[model samples]
Target: MRTKVAIIGAGPSGLLLGQLLHTFGVDNIILERQTPDYVLGRIRAGLLEEGTVSLLDQVGAGARLHQEGLVHHGVELAFGGARHRIDMHAATGKTVTIYGQTEVTLDLMNARKAAGLTSVYSASDVKPHDFDTDHPRVTYVKDGVSHEIACDFIAGCDGFHGVSRASVPASAITSYERVYPFGWLGILSETPPVSPELIYNNHERGFALCTMRSSHRSRYYVQCPLDDHVDQWSDDRFWDELKRRLDQKAADELVTGPSIEKSIAPLRSFVAEPMRFGRMFLAGDASHIVPPTGAKGLNLAASDVHYLSQALREYYDEKSSAGLDGYSARALARVWKAVRFSWWMTSMLHKFPDEGEFAARIQIAELDYLVSSKAASTSLSENYVGLPF
Candidate 1:
């Protein structure tokens, strides 16, 4: 088979890119290592930056999102036994939509199916060949049969553990990574959130966040040791701990319920330099990873997709390689900024095992200053709502 672009992975990035290309009259096919159900079942960040929402609108996938997604002008930061609100809209003239990534994937997948875009799910041994040459091809196996797709370009949107990045030679890629000492033990429950807006808390016990997918479904997280297991935490104990760490008002309003989903995600910041290689380009988690503190993971992916989609559009329409040639530098420039913001938020809110009491006091001071200083709060709000694409 021959197409203009051969996309790897059926995740949000890959699916979103494919849809955008299809809308531009660019022929492409998506390959996934798992079933559609498996991809949709994966829970991920729900905060949608303004740019991301606009991208969905461009692809005609915003009908469900705009109807179901929550719009928030601000988020609360709880520290020193108080809850402080940062007006993101007032600070930066922007707002965020709380729509789960799973829903975004479903929207794109349904849109792709309706448009008759080809996507190969459960594709095994997916590999890109001859990307350095003018003609490139992707080979994979489906149903025990081998197949090849000859394309002008390849999009490596597969993610961190996907074959896209790993396929590149180590000498050509420079990776920078930092694994935090703690992990987030999060739970999803069918209960109302403690607050209407998301609350990011810095408490003596640990860092905790109160967020939600909707009015009735809450997602909560607390910092825990790396060795902590899900079996070690009970529903009651988790609620009790969450309440203890929150302010009096938030704690009193908190509702407890059985956890529908629970998991421990380790915090880390990772970035791979030069997202483009030959005719293949990496986007989303394939090139970088940020801690969940600032909720930048999915947003970063969207920005990368936006850049890449635009680049490919230019290449095909104007017959210009300018955008494609500049994809790496353009994407990485924004990627690094988000990496810094997430790292700063994680460092300020979470406890460090080695820092002792001095660091704890310093963290509290920083949080205090952030709430008191309009400049500092606006900076935080700007990054939270997302930097301009």
Candidate 2:
């Protein structure tokens, strides 16, 4: 079988690319390692930058998002027994919404299917063919038999663990990486939010965050040892720690009883240079990984797709490869900005026990100054809310 484009991984990047290609009257197919239900049900990053929301609307996938998303004008930076708001609207003249990634994915899926496109799920062991040639293909096993789908090119949106990157020679890809000393163990509770805006707190005890996933659901996180396990903490202990770190004001705040789900996320910064090789190109987490402090993950992926989609559209319609040729370095420009912003935010907050008392005090002092100075707070808010796609 063959297609104009063969995309790996049905995550946002891959799915959105397929939808964009269809908009340009190009035919494409997407292969995902996860089941459709799983991909649709996976609850992850929800904050969509204004640019990303605009892309969704242009691609015909914003019906559910525009209706269900909680639009936020700013986030609260809490430290030193006080809470400060970094007004995003005032800083960047932009807005971000508290819509989960799952909502966006479902919306994309519905729009794609309505436009007569289907994604094959549970497709494991995807192999990119002819990396050095202009025409390449993706071969994978769907159910019981192996199949090869030839295509003009392949988009490796399979994320960090996917096989497309592995297909490139080790010598050709230069990777830069740094692993942090701590991780965020977050929980999703079936309760109402305690605050109007997202709260990010840094205390000697730990780094904690309070935010809402939806009207009826609250999302919370706290710093833990990099190797800490979720089983180490109980439901009661979770709420207690959150309240202590957050300094809950109301008695009925965060009605935490059942611990629905918990996850540990390691902090890291990863980037692979030259995201393209012959017929295969990388997009999304497949090329870079940023700590979630800046809330840039989903937006970055969407931005990469927006560029890639534009490039592919130019190549197919105008018979010009100028846009396609500029994909990597162009995407890298924004990627590194986000990488730096995420690292900076992570450093500005998160207390490090290994650094001793002096270092911890210095971190607090810096946070104090950052929030105290309007210019500094503006920089933080601009970086946190992000720029155009």
Best by lDDT: 1
Kindly give the number of clashing pairs for every candidate: 0, 1
Predict model 1's lDDT versus the native. 0.94
Which residue pairs clash in candidate 2? 46-100
Per-residue error at 244 for model 1, in Å? 1.2
When summed lDDT is taken over every stretch of 10 residues in candidate 2, the lowest stretch is: 246-255
Give one digit per residue, the lDDT tens place, for model 1 in 293-356: 9999999999999999999999999999999999999999999999999999999999888788
For model 1, state the Cα shift of residue 124 in Å: 1.0
Q: Model 2, range 137-207, lDDT digits (tens) per residue?
A: 88889777898998998999999988989889999999999899999988988888778789888877888
Best by TM-score: 1
